[model samples]
Target: MSALSQLDRGVAPIETGMLPRPFVVRSRREELADCVTLELAALDGEPLAFEAGQFTMLYVHGIGEVAISISGDTAKPDSLIQTVRAVGAVSQAICGLAEGARVGVRGPLGNSWPVERAVGKHLMIVAGGLGLAPVRPIIYWALANRDRLKSVDIVYGTRAPDQILFARQLLGLSAADGVRVGITVDLADQDWSGQVGVVTDLIPSMLRDPDETVAMVCGPEIMMRFSGQALVGAGVPAEETFLSMERNMKCGIGWCGHCQLGPHLICRDGPVFAYPAVRDLMSVWEL
Candidate 1:
């Protein structure tokens, strides 16, 4: 019998971060050469509720587990969605899973973006590369709550045209009322004619009133740092700007020290933080 089956049936089981819930891969879509977006459904038929900026520890059976951000609409709780980039052993295993494969999930862990704070203000979502996946839920939230928000502006930058994730979806979002989307790339091919520069370069044109804008940025550490600087320089308050920091998180819980940045644990204290909270540490080389 399994270890779980041998446990005393008379006693109540304690919930822990290490215990994984079962989920089945309902569908998977290739977003880029190395990334795939998986739509998961709980085997128990219950919903996996999650906030916009939270991530989950996805376990690939005997392979291992990796923390991945939720990329689906928050309002739709019945289905769990995660975008996985095949960068490591576990993620590679996950990306290779077929439909109907069973996977283990540990959480909707970590804190979330303060999107509600921008209810009455302009919501500016800035992302670079795959960073867009982590912040896509905010876009869904903004679109749904458009009447409550002053404006919704999204600025995205990727290394090249082909590297863009959710390209067609972003195109559709651009046409939404009260929403504006700006896209840029570091390099362009013959078919590309959009802006050719870093995402920070597009900040000026997207910002209508810095004082009234709340910026949420996620990308590589270097990209997020520069984006924060650009937003602050454009007159947005440092506290009004938030960033999602990706680190070497071994455990979704704080038991592991791998995700520590100074006094904060990226997995526990935040993957999402006010720009001012991590600005200094982000500048440190290899810290």
Candidate 2:
């Protein structure tokens, strides 16, 4: 997920940019074998107002910090929610935090999806694996503003049926009016009844009007590249389709050059960008 071009949303908390605020873990839910979703409340009683798609740097005491996207409802700013997959030392520490555990938080930072631009236009959200965590905020925003938009289509693909995140919620969303949810897994077992294929295979079916659709896609680099191409091939304007980029970010802000991608910094210029903005760079091998 990314942010708006300008940092004028006033979405950041009251604390200074570089400082971390005290937040207590209010709840934790296990989403997978190594993934957990945590809800945190600020100890100072201040709400971290954030735009959908922005992320935060979560710091576990005696451990370290890692950037994770906000995965809660934007309407509820007082409680911060983030889903963590225990892939690294810092992330594992975050995933292991128990209820009432205290942690340091910096941000609610970076750009957001240009959701307002999708108003009066059909919106499509696509995600793969944990990419859903970053793009989940947009789904919440779209559902809240359903009347303002034409339609909402969500296409998600993961490795297996057991790997699905927010399964019950996704089931309920499929029944919501004006919303279409299509889920697929790369492989399936005897108990699975859903489609089995890459996410792109389901894209054309969910799209109502290709030219009038605005898409937001987040996944691995190759998946996003193909998705962008598919959207353009189906008649959506390249500029109207956005993809979130990820890199090895040391500093959530752009101070460190670890996240540089050619001329752009993944942490600053984007984590989200229109397809045209990153199309060429994405084609390069490990640039």
How far does residue 180 in candidate 1 sit from its true spot (Å)? 0.4
TM-scores of all candidate predictions against the true structure:
0.95, 0.93
lDDT of 1 by residue, 1-287 (tens): 33244344433322546678999999999999999999999999989999999999999989998999999999999989999999989999999999999999988999999999999999999999999999999999998999999999999999999999999999777554678999999999999989999999999999999999999999999999999999999999999999999887787778768999999999989999999899999999999
State each model's CA lDDT, in order. Answer: 0.92, 0.89
Candidate 1: misplaced stretches above 4 Å? Answer: 1-14
Q: How well does model 1 score by local distance difference test? A: 0.92
lDDT (Cα, 0-100) at 209 in candidate 1? 96
Error of 1 at 152 (Å): 0.4
Error of 1 at 154 (Å): 0.3
Error in Å for residue 105 of model 2: 0.5
Q: List clash counts for every candidate, in order.
A: 0, 5
